[model samples]
Target chain A: MTGLVSLFRRLEGPQTLGRGPAFWALFALVLAGALAYPLFSDGYTVGNTVYFFVWVFIALSLSLIWGYGGSLSFGQTAFFGIAGYGYGILTINFGAAYGFTWIALLLAIGMAALVAALLGYFMFFGRIAGVFLGIVTLAVTLMLERFMAQTAGPEWRIGAARLNGFNGMSAMPPLTIPWFGGPIPLFADVGLYYVVLAMLVLVYLGLRILMNSSFGNVIVAIRENPERAEMLGYDIRKYQLITFVIGAALAGLSGVLYTVWGQYITPSSMGMTAASLPLIWVAVGGRSDLTATVIGTLVVLSGFQALTIYGSQYALVFMGVLLVLTVLIAPNGLVLGVIKGITKLVTRRKQEAA
Target chain B: MALLQLRDVNKHFGGLHVTNSVNLVLEQGEIHCLIGPNGAGKSTLFRLILGEHHPGSGQIYFAGEDITTLKSFARIRRGLSVKFQVPGVFKGLSVRQNLEIALQSRLHGAALDKEIDRLLAFLNLEAEQAQLAGNLSHGQKQWLEIGMAIALKPRLLLLDEPTAGMSPEETHMTGEMVRRLNAAGMTVLAIEHDMAFVRQVAQRVTVLHLGQVFAQGSIDEIVADERVAAIYLGQAHA
Candidate 1:
């Protein structure tokens, strides 16, 4: 028994559980809640939970770049909006079926990846870092939103009597799983909830794998010190560009999932508000921990929804408060703080016992 | 032919001429020591050679190839590496991980682990391999940085104050290590303020004053030069 325990401990690395058990526990609980939602909650509540999951993916993507990769971006929503548009164009204009939609989604993700690569190459290679990178991405988001609004015009407006300007796109087709059943109506909240939940799990696992890879170590090294990473023979610019593209592609994937669930896509998705939300999610969640990012997204999104009962305006105020409090009290994020607190308490108890 | 050559290298930071038309050549297996007072542009000249700073004019030839315009990583790829004045290691990573990254860059794939193990053994860092780099003492960090520089088996290594902030014992150990490296066919260009340490290791020495080479010869000859002693060694009568 002792040998087995020691083997497990060695595999997990020293300080692994101490640094992150609370975070892991919290993630597991949230995942359990996600799994239980479809069965326990009413259709409307289930639908909202599905919406939260989509944003969780977006938040995770943002955390990967801003938190781990140490590249702040405000143009994530550009990729999100582009993916939605790709889905819309494929289903509505190109008459693509389920199989082709999947292909189109991949292609859309590729397009977003390309955009991210190009932008990162220009920005990072030119040695523009920190605030300048943020400003550039913010400008790109604003430009894309304006361009989309202009090109979308009045005629191709989504729903009748709604220019999709303020009301947004509608009647997006439902995703079908041929093996399980025919078309699963995304309007069926349970179906969408499961789909989003499954995607979130897959994405989290994929990102976990990525973060553990040697390439990911290089990214972390770059984040710690770009000059040191360069001296170690890493082409910092190439790694930065690759990270940007991967993060953007993930954001685009989340966008596709969001459009399918919401049955709509809007120019607003490319706006500053949408772009900023994911960054806030990263801030609320510990930037270094993906599980914390998901938790932060769920908490913030739930708070926003709950506040909406009072008034829509209060949501932004709540977010502002959360941001300020998290930054001041727990700059590493609430999850990290809680984990550290727990570890300290445990160690204190151990010392007392000794 | 020299392993590394800088011909009339000039670097100007706006109005200040940091490296003013300096020429230097380092032969293979040579321990070339650069000594200068503070602000004598020794660090600046090192940066210029490592491609961290572009020379305003003139050329840097490495193994007969002009590498003046190459980027830092490109120069590193061409078997040129540098250890900074301040020990530069990834603080978040473990000692072994730091060495692993360097080894990976040099060898990649299957050979990475074996190479890293060899380097760990060479540096006597196998015991502290799992320790975070940030936890390492200043001297240890310096040794780790040197270990990383040699991980790629670079033909020419530029070390900027390798013994700075080290204990006497650590300094002696580092000097011995540098000698071993030089004897085993690595060309080294080192900057040092400690004349005693330099004398113990460097076969040839160049003393810099202002931004130009003040004197260059065998250590004994340069030490004995009256002009060098008067101007650089701060002796009124030499």
Candidate 2:
């Protein structure tokens, strides 16, 4: 196992930290904590845990784009909201006979991926980059918010699903699996919590595998220097488009999961502020490191949630301060520093033993 | 036939004729050094061959095929690689990862461990395998970039100023490395400003003056040429 880890370290290298048995132990502990949460908590508290998992997915999506793929986007919510609407409308129109839950999820994921690919094709090939890329992505989010908000009339109905506009869709079909033992609703608080936790583990594992693959190496190389990568025979625009589409697909999936938990959809959730939430999470966590980004999202998000309970007005201020400190003190993310410190301690012990 | 041939290639940036009806050839298995003043179009000729900028007129042939219309990467895929004027190593990646990226550029998805092991050993960078490339010294980074350039395993390597900022020892080491690679049958085309370093590695010299080849001969012959000494002596000192 150590040999494999070292080989991967040599192949993928120092971009990742503490990616050995110690890291796996921490992962296992987190898994255990998530699995044990619902057993000790009420339905409402379990619901909050599920929400945290959803946000983790959103933050991971942003990290993949910005940290790994090296594209900063401010409109991930556009894809998220697209997936939400796709789920709501399709589930409503299809009804329970077919129980098209899986179909609805696919639709949502596809919708966002397609839109992102189109936007990426234009932006990357047109050579629109840096801050301009951020602006274009933000425009997409704002346009979605305004367009969805205006769909508040009788004429805005899609099949059985009514476009409630600013008032919002109060209910959607529950997440269900057509079990051989009959249908099982996955959205029952404890069940939904487990599903989200399992999905989080799967996504984390999948991303880890990808981050060490040749594809991941190429993407990181492109992020560092597009011209150099291009000169080395890589099609830079193709890879950029691929990264954008993957991020959008993940955000869309996160939106589907959010819709399942909240049992509703709202235009406000697709606004600029909502979109920026993932960016802040990624920034505070350490944008380039996956583990750091996840840790940052969880700790900072829970901190903000705790603040809101104490004094809602001060939560934003606290978040702002946290972001400022993260930027100034640990620009790589506080979690990265923690990982480095752990690595140092382990190496010191090994040297002493020798 | 030459390994690379440029026939009357001309390029212009609006009104500035950077490459004025330039004709050149690089024969196989030879060490060729290109030297000229800053605006003498030495680098522009490299770009024209790499397909970064297409000639306004004329043709580029590589290994005897017309490649004037090929894109930069397409040309690379045909077994050509370049070491840029600037250090082009990926700073965020480790030395090992950087080498892996380069090797993967030419050879894909197999036992690259053997090749990577060989490269690390050849460059004597095994101790810094896990070190982040950004932390490498300027000379180390230069060698690492050379490691990356050779990692492509190109039949022809275009090196743009391999000893620009190196000390005498480092420059001598670089010259040795270039000679070793050429000895092993890899054709090298180098652009150099350091005359001492050039004389160390030069087999033949091509001097460009104002977008055209002013003279081409063995190093001793060119150094003894009155016209060559007069045009370059002032700029070379400066």
User: Highest TM-score among the candidates is held by which one?
Assistant: 2
Which pairs of residues collide in candidate 2? Answer: none
Among residues 3 or more apart in sequence or in different chains, the pairs in candidate 1 whose N, CA or C atoms overlap within 3 Å are: none
Local accuracy of candidate 1 as per-residue lDDT tens digits, B1-238: 6999989999898899888889988998899999877888999998898888999999999999999999888889889888899999988779988887777655754578788888888787889999999999999999899999998788998999999998888888899999999889998999997777798899899988778888899889988888876766465321
- Compose the digit string of candidate 2's lDDT tens values, residues B116-155: 8888888878999899889998888888889888888788
**What is candidate 2's CA lDDT for residue A103?**
84
My TM-score estimates for the predictions, one after another, are 0.88, 0.93
| Per-model TM-score of chain B | 0.94, 0.94
lDDT leader: 2
Q: Please report how far candidate 1 places residue B45 from its true position, in Å.
A: 1.6
Error (Å) of candidate 1 at residue A330 is 1.9
lDDT of 2: 0.85
Docking quality of model 1: it rates as medium
